[model samples]
Each structure stands twice: as structure tokens, then as C-alpha cells.
Target chain A: MESVLEVKGLSKKYPSFELKSVGFHVDPGMVMGFVGRNGAGKTTTLKSILNLVHPDAGSVRVFGLDFMENEDVIKQQIGYAVGGVSYYNRKRICDIVAVTKMFYENWDDSEYKHYLNAFKLDENKKLKELSSGMKVKFYLTLALSHHAKLLILDEPTSGLDPVSREEITDIFTKLAQKGVAILFSTHITSDLDRCADSITYIKNGELMFSGNKSEFIRSYTESMGKVPSLEEIMVFIEKEEVVL
Target chain B: MGKLLKKEMKLTASPLSYWFILFSFMTFLPGYPILVGGFFVCLGIFFTYQQAVEYDDITFSALLPIRKKDVVKAKYAFVIIIQMISFVLSALFTVLRMTLLSEAKVYLVNQMMNANLFYLGFLLLVFAVFNTCFMKGFFKTAYRIGKPFIIFCIAGFLLIGVGEMLHHLPGMEALNSTSGTSLIQAFVLLFGIVIYVVQTLISMNSSERNFEKIDL
Candidate 1:
């Protein structure tokens, strides 16, 4: 299968924290769960791949193109959801969509309306007025409407209600079936249990494990001598990584 | 780049507040220096500069497919467009000032015709210096207002001081004469344009480089 995304030797340094040589890949038609504790380089890694942060040394390839060389072209086919930003607070939802639509080459207004209707969003509402869950829905709607081939979401499910989470998870499944690669970070491990085909777990700026989801769980069971839920497996892995 | 410009116009389009400032400023158009000076202050303080470093705008643009360099370019383009609007408005106000208050301010209109071309040139230089200063190290968006303002304040004062000295030169006829500006003032106007172009180019290059290194 052709990989939709690839990160190699990605490293970023900060005053108090450093993301040291982390790497991973996600193929087309696959949904990869990016699991990490708070400040474990999940957002940093994502930002690096997006070139939001200039990495100290690394290469990021998306759709077989070096992201730095073909950033504009590659980004057109990718949707990034950094949830619940209070950008343009004075602008209405309709205005935001209008402006954002012009940025993408393949923005679908009809598809956007369908998501707005399905999500029960009011286009006239200001961004400041939307609840956290509603904001995530808005971001997702923006991503999906752009006809993006790959969706990269950063902690999009954190404040969402259970029902909204389920709804979005369903949308991800549908997107993946349509051959849209997905890589989302979520603390809600159960969301992944039903959706993610692969998992990459990170801790303190290191990848603890990156492979098939079931194999990750089975590795935990084999090492710890018992089966555990995904969340339990995460805690065990972090603990083991710390001990090592 | 056109797409980048389009996105920038959309981002800066704060319908009410934006128009409100323009309307209010136009209502009280002042002399050459004050009119254009007020325009920059209002735009910098109330809109573009604030918007330039906005956390949300930065984050939002990062999600778009455009190059990091284009983001900086688009920002510069927006400021330039705002300056162009001010130019158009100033020209109209000059006409209104000359026609409506013709007899009372004959000198102002005369200045508009000849030597006062220096005013437009000076304003462009001031705005370029101001934006260039503000955009350098822009990623450190917070607590940076004072530095650039101070630098621009000195530039403003220096320009005034130089103009004052030039006005007193021995060969100079009265600066307020109805005939037109002297040859020296024309040279000064050309000089201002030179500085504007060179400074703006330097600023654009540096801002692009600094922004790429910034951890957004």
C-alpha cells in the first residue's frame, strides 16, 4: 500500500523539552491512532510534519513529495484540524467558511452544507458562541468539505460529548473507507479501539511502540502476563518506558 | 500568491471596525503629515499589526496549504493595500480641502499641486519603516509593541527635523508659497522613495527568514 504520510528522524528542541528523533508512517486507507501522554511530543510531531515548527533535522514526506519542497501542493490534499481556535471571533461561521473555501482548490460547498446540516450547526453563529464540541464539528466539516485525501487532527475529541465523539468516529471510518488516510491524536482510547487499524504510542518524546493495534495489545499481554484494555496498555507502556 | 492575497483580505475583513476607523479618520482629515501619520497609527494600532501576530490567525494559516513564506508575503500585501486605500482617500480629501475651503487654505492646495508630493513620499517611508520594524521578530508576538513604536517615533521625529532644517536653507523660498515646492524638496521626495523601497525590500526578506525559523 502507498503511504500517505511519512516522518523520518524528526527532532525538535525546546527550553525544557526535546522531541528526539521520533518517526512514523501512515498508509492510504488506514486510520492510525497517535497515543501519547500530555506533552509527549504528539502536537510537536504533528506541527513538525506540517512545517509549523522548523525541525532541527528531519525529512517529512507526504504523498511521495518532500513536504518542504512541495508544501503548497501537498497541503492542498491534506486537512488539518487544530480544534477550537477562537480565530476571527467577530466573523460569522458563514464568513469563515467563505474565506477558507477560497484557500483550497477543491472545496465543496454542497458537501459543506451537508455536514453543517448533519452536524446541526448554525452558519450564522460566531465562533466564540459555539460550544467546544460544536467547534470540533465545525473544524471537521471544514476538513471534509475540502475533499482532503488525508486528515490530521490534534486532540479533536478532548472536550467533545460522548455522542459527538461517536458521530465523529463514524465519520472517520467513512473517510477511511473512501481511501482518506487518517491520523488523529486522542486521549479517548476507546474511540481508537473501534476505529484505528494501527497505533503509535509515544512517551516523553520517544516512540514506545508503532505497529498493528492488536499486536500492540498482544505485546502488552505477553509481557505483563495478562490482557488489558487499550487505555491500560498505554499506562503499562509508559511505565515500562520510564523503567527502561 | 493571488490565493494568499485573497485569504489575507478575507482574514483582515473586519467589516464594522475596519470601516469605522476609515470613516472616522476621513471625517477629520488633517494637514499632510498628520493625515498620513494618523492613517498609519490607526491601521497599526487598531488592525493589521494586532492581526499580524494573532495566535489564532497564525495557527489557522498553518493549517492551510500555502508556504510559510507566502503567509509573510500575504501579510505585507495586506498592509500595502491598506496604504493604497489611504492614498486614494488622501487624494480625495486634498481635492475636497482645496475646492471646499479654497480661499481660506490656498497654500494647502498649492502644496498639494507641487512640493507637497513630499508628503506622500514621506508617508510611504514611515509606513515601510514601521511595518518592517514590527514584522522583524514578529513570532514573539507579545510585549513587542513598544520597541517598534519607539523606532518609528524616532524616524517620524527625524523626518520632521530634517524637513525643518531643509525649509530654512538659504536658497529656499518660503515653503508655503502658492507657486510650488523648491528643487531641494523634489530631491528630498526622491530620496524618501529610495529609502522606502530599499527598507521595505530588506524587511520583507528578513521577515520571511525570521518567520520560517519561528516555532509557530
Candidate 2:
């Protein structure tokens, strides 16, 4: 199957930090986990692909079409659920949704209502009233309601409890099974191990690895001469770098 | 674009902005510098921008299925809509002052800028200055509102002072006319419209380009 998203040589430079030539791809029905420590350029990479930040160098293609040239069309099929940014904190959930739904041609109101019910979200409640975990679910609801083919989530399960994380991971697994590609960034490797089919690791603005999840684990296990979990592999590599 | 405009009016805008349009009624004040009425209208729109920043509205809009340019366009359209509503109100009040209240003692003896077509034109110029300065500066980073707003206030008030000073000039006495409209007043209103349109369009395009480079 053709890839749902392709990013090539994406580069962005800031005064104090720079994102190097980063690239990755996600296929339909695949869940790709983007892993990195803080300040590893994961957010920058995602922003560049979404055109929230203009890339200094490189190209991003969504469904084999140039992202910049076909941004509106591509964005329509992509659901982006960023973790921390809040929208209209003073407005009720229903009010914000009423404004948001008008922009999408394929908005599925029944699906939205279904997710709202499943998540136990109160439509009359202001966004500020929702807890952080609930806020993530709310963003996910907005993302899923429009029938997005690709979901780009930034740290969707960062601060959640283990049970909440499990619930979100189960949701991801089901979505991938339904042929929706998901690329999510997270520091929680356990979540990736649970649901991700592929893993892309970044270190200090550079791509350390990007491939099948088991292959990544196998490569690390062979090099270290023992079986290791995804979290162990990440910790071991990061510690080794610190020692070196 | 229409959808984006709806987003601005419904989601991002402050409700205080609508209430501020009532500031145009200040033209009915007897001896006050009625140009401050226009400033209040712009202040209302400024509050919307302030509220948008607090709500992270820019990032939210960036995530929508719209171009960065469309976001800037929607804001400019919102500003214009608010301004035009206030403008129409000021116009109605100016007509009232020039007609039924034309012979009222307070308006007749007021030494400040009289409620006239020239006042309407100067008000548009005030909005033009604000839009050109504020939009250009704000979009450079899309978050810094303080500096741009201060600069616009200086420019806006300077224009207001100049508008007040014009009638005192020997050849421009018709600018403060209360009872009758002059050819000069018509020309001033025409000139203000041209400036407002051209300035807003150029500055909006510049702001769109600036915003395209911002990383939300």
C-alpha cells in the first residue's frame, strides 16, 4: 500500500537550536511512534510537516501530493491532536465545536456525538473545566470526528495514568486496524510497545532510527547481547551516550 | 474564507467588541473630543486580539484546514466589519448634529472638532492608521500585541490632533462646519476612504506574509 505520509530532509534552524535533516514515513493501517527525550526536535519536525512552521529545507508529501501546494486538501484528511495548547478556554465545548465543524467538508456529527458520549465529555462545559487527560480526549474527539485518514498527535498520553494510557492505546490499536495511519510522539515507550507497529527515534535533532518496531528491538538486543524492552533500549542508549 | 470569518466572530472574538460599537454614540456628547469615540471602537477590537492570544486562538486556527493567509484575512475582515458598524453609527449621529441639533447652543459654541462629514472622514483615517500599524507589527511574530498597539495609539492620536488642527488653518475652516456640507468635506471623506482601503489591503498582505513564516 502507498504511504499515507512522507517527509524528506526536513530542516529548521533557530538561534539556539536546529532540527537537522529529519525524515520518516507512515503507511496506511500503521501506527508509527515518534520517540525522543525533551528538546529532541520532535515537535519541530511535526510542526514543519503540518506547515505550522515553514521548513528551511525539505519537502513533505501527504498521500503522494506536495504538502505546501495542496495544504488545505491534505489537512482535511489529517487529524492533529496537540497536547498542551488549549482552544477557547472560556467557551463551552459545544460552542467551540460549532465553530470548528464548519471548516470540514466531511464532518461526521454522529461520529462526533458518539465519541463525546464514549469519552463522557459534557458539551456545555468550558474547556478549562476539563482535566488534562480529559483535554487530550477532547482533542482526540475533534480529530476523529472528521474521519481523518492520518492522525498526527503530539504526546497524546504524556501525563495520563496507566489506566488512561491503556485506554488511549486501545483506541489507537482499533483505529490502526481500521486503516487509519497514526504518527504520535511520546516519551512513554510502554505505550509505543503496546500499539506501535513502527518506531522513529530522534536524538538531538537527528534521526537515530526509523523502522519496524521488532526490528529495532532485535537490532538493539543483538548489539547488547540480551533481550530488552523498548523502554530499556531507550534508557540504555541514552545512558551510554551520557557516559561517552 | 467565510468559514474562517465565522470562526473569528463566533469563537475567537471577544463579546466586548460588539458592545464597543456603542462608543460611536459618544458623538452626541456636547463638548468632548468626539474623535475619542473612534479610538474606543478600535480598542474594542484590540481586546479581541488580546483575548485570542490568551485562548491560543492562533495555534487553533493554524490547525484548521485553512491557509495561513486565510487566517489573516479573516481577522482583517472582522476588524473592518466592526469598524464599518461604528462608522455608520457615527455617520447617523453626525447627520443628527448637522440637522435637528444644528442650532443647539452647545454644538454651535463647541470649539473642538464639530460633528461633520470631516469628522467621519478623520475617524476612518484613525482606523486606517491603526490597521496599518497594528497588523504589520502584530503579524511579525503573531503574539506580541503591546508594542504594535502602543505605536498605533501614537499614530492614531497624532492624526486626530492633525484633524483638529486643520480647521484652525486659514484655508481649511470648512472642516469644522456644522450646518452645511461643503465640497471640501466631501473631498476629505473620499480621501479618507481611499487611504483606509489602500492601507488596509497593503498591510494585510504584508501581515499574511509575515504570519506564514511564524512557527505556532
Candidate 3:
């Protein structure tokens, strides 16, 4: 299968934190779970791919295009959801939609309205006045309406209610059925187990594992004499300093 | 470039900023006649600078399908547009004020011509201000690096004061009546503009470098 996204030797440094060389690839029609603990450089990696944050070293490619050299072209095919729910404070939901529509050529108004109704979001309400869950729904609606081929989400379900989370998971499943490659970063392992085709683990800014989800689960179960949880596996890997 | 400019306009279309720009410009229309033109021009400059920094919108802007050069050009264009509008508004108000006061019409016209020249000078000053404020590491170390800008503005005010004092001298009056540009004056003006443009470009390059270094 052809890869939809690729990262190689990506690294970024700061005074307090450093993201070491991290690498991964997601094939078309695959849902890749990017599992990591808090501050594990998940957001940093997403930011690098989005070109919001530039890496000190290495490269990211989406749809076979260099992210930095072809950012404008790459971004058109990408649908990104930030970790938290934040938008222009004074802007109404409809206003946000209108502005986003201007930038994205493939924006589907009908899809946007459908998601708005599904999430029970008032199109006229200022984003700041909406609840955290509502804001997440709004962002998801915007992301889905863009007709993006690659979905890059950063902890998208962090603060959602179970019902909302299920809705989002279902949406992901529907998108995946259409062969949209997804890179979903989250600490919630249960969501990954339910939807992810493959899993990639990162710790201390380094890739620990990247393989099929079932294979990963089977390996951990055989080794530990129990059906180990993804989180548990992550902890074990970190403790052992496993490089694969 | 058009798309970027459109986005900028949309982002800044809030009623509060619109009124702020209007009120700032109108404040110059009827107040002290001596600085009437400078008042509007300065207000427009402050408005543009404040909006640029306040939105921190440039970070998001950099992600769009636009070149860095276009981004810089659009920002400069936005500032220039605002200044042009403020100039026309101030000029119209000045005309109405003089007509109401029954003042010498020709004198008002000449004063308006000088005001236009001052407007050009103000443009150079604004460019200088933006360069100094946004140049190397300025946004990263905003408050600390901004001290020099405040000092520069003060020095500018003092220099204008000195010019005013010199204007009252006997020889200076004759010098003002001369129409032909002195080579030295032309060189000084040209050099100032070149420096301002160079600094503007450097400031933009520094900002791009800073964006690359930021870890989001």
C-alpha cells in the first residue's frame, strides 16, 4: 500500500524540551493511532507536519510532497484538529464556517450543516460562549467539511463526553471506509483499540513502535501472559528503553 | 496576494477596530491646527501596528497558500490604505474648517500642500518605526527591544522641535521660499527612505526566521 504521510529523522529542540529524531508512515486507507503520554511530543509532531512549528532537523512529507517546500499544496489536502477547543472568541459558528470556506476550495456546506445539527451546535453562538465539548464538535465539523484526504488530529477527544467521543469515532470509521488516511493522537487507548488499523508509539520524542494494531496486541499478550493494555505496553517499553 | 489581503480584511473587520480607526483619525480633524495632519497620520500608523501585534494573526497567516514576500507586501499595503483614507478625511475636514473660519483660502491651500509633503515624511517615519519594532528578535523580546523605539520617537519629537526653532531664523525663511531641491536635502531624503526599506525587508526576514525557530 502507498503511504499517505511520511516522517523521517524529525527533531526539534527547546530550552525545556527536546523532540529527538522521530519517524513514522501511514498508508492510504489505514488509521494510525499516535499513542503517547502527556508532553510526549505528539502535539509537537503534528505542529511540525502542519508547518506551524518548524523542525530543527529532518523532513515531513504528505502525499509525496515535502511539507516545507510545498506547504500550500500539502495543507490543501490536510484536515487538522488542534488538541483543545479554541476559536476566535467573538466569532459566531457560522462566521467561522464562512471564513474557513473562503480558504478551503472543497468545503462542503451541506456536510458542515449536517455535523452542526448532529452535534446540536447553534450556528449563531459565539465560539467562546460554547461549552468545551461544543467547541470540539465545531472543529470536527469544520475538519470534515473540507473533503480532506489526510486527517491529522491532536488529542481530539481529550475533553469530550462519552457520547460525543463515540460520535467522533463513528465519523472516523466512516471516513476510513472511504480510504482517508488518519493520524489520530490521543492518550485514550480504548478509542485506538476500537478504530485504529495500526498503532505508533512515541516516548520522550522518539518512536518506540510502529506496526499493525492486532500484531502489537498479540505480541504484548504473548510476552506478558495477559492481554496488556496499550498504556501498559507503553509504560513497559519506556521502562525497558525499547527502540523498535 | 489577493487572498491574503482578503483574509486580513476579514480578520480585521470587527466593528471595534473599525470604529477605533475612525475615531483616531477624526480626533485630528478639528483639534490643534499646527499638528492636524500629523495627528491623523500618527493615529493611522498606531492603529495598523496595534492590530498587527494584537491579533498575533500573522502566525496563522503564515500557514496560508501565500509567499512570505506577499505576506509582507499585503501588510504594508493595509497600512498604506488606512493612511490614504485618513489623509483624505483629514484634508476634507481641514477645508471645511477653514471655510467656516473665513480664513485666507490660498494660505489654507499652501498649508495643505505642505501637509501632503509632511504626509510623505510621516510614511518614512512609519516605515522606520515598523522596522525598529519588528526587526531581529523584536517580537520574541518585544517589551525589552521596544525601548529603543520609544526612544526613537522621543528623539524624533525633539528633532522636530529643533526644526521649528530653526524655521523662525532669518535665513531659514529665505531657504523655505526656494523651490529647487538642494542636492544635499534630496540625498538625505533618498537615503532615509532607502534605509527604511532595507530595514523593513530585514525585519520581515527576521520574523520568518523566528517563525521557523518557534516550536508552535
Enumerate residue pairs that collide in model 1. Answer: none
**Per-prediction DockQ:** 0.57, 0.77, 0.31
What value does the lDDT take at residue A157 in candidate 2?
89
lDDT (Cα, tens digit) per residue for candidate 1, span A1-244: 6689998999988899999898889999899999988889999999899988889988999999999999889888898886555667666899888888888889998999998998899999988789877887888888889888889999878877888788778878888998999999876798898789999888889888888998999888877788889989877666654454
Once fitted onto the true fold, the runs of candidate 3 whose alpha carbons sit more than 4 angstroms away are A237-244, B13-16, B23-56, B91-116, B123-128, B131-215
Residue pairs whose backbone atoms clash in candidate 3? A208-A244
RMSD in Å for model 3 = 5.4
Q: Which has the higher TM-score value, candidate number 1 or candidate number 2?
A: 2
Tell me the tens digit of each residue's lDDT in model 3 across B106-142.
4443322222223333435444554455334444432
TM-score of each: 0.86, 0.96, 0.78
lDDT per residue for candidate 2 within A20-114, as digits (tens), equals 99998999999999999988899999989999888899999999999999998988889998776678988999999999999889999999999
For model 1, what is the error of residue B207's alpha carbon versus the real structure, in angstroms, after optimal superposition? 1.6
- Cα shift from native, residue B97, model 1 (Å): 5.6
Kindly give the number of clashing pairs for every candidate.
0, 0, 1
lDDT of 1: 0.72
Best-performing candidate as measured by lDDT? 2
lDDT of 2 at B19: 97
Angstrom error at residue A225, model 1: 3.2
lDDT of 3 at A92: 79
Model 3: how far is B215 from its true place, Å?
4.6
**What is the full ranking by TM-score, best candidate first?**
2, 1, 3
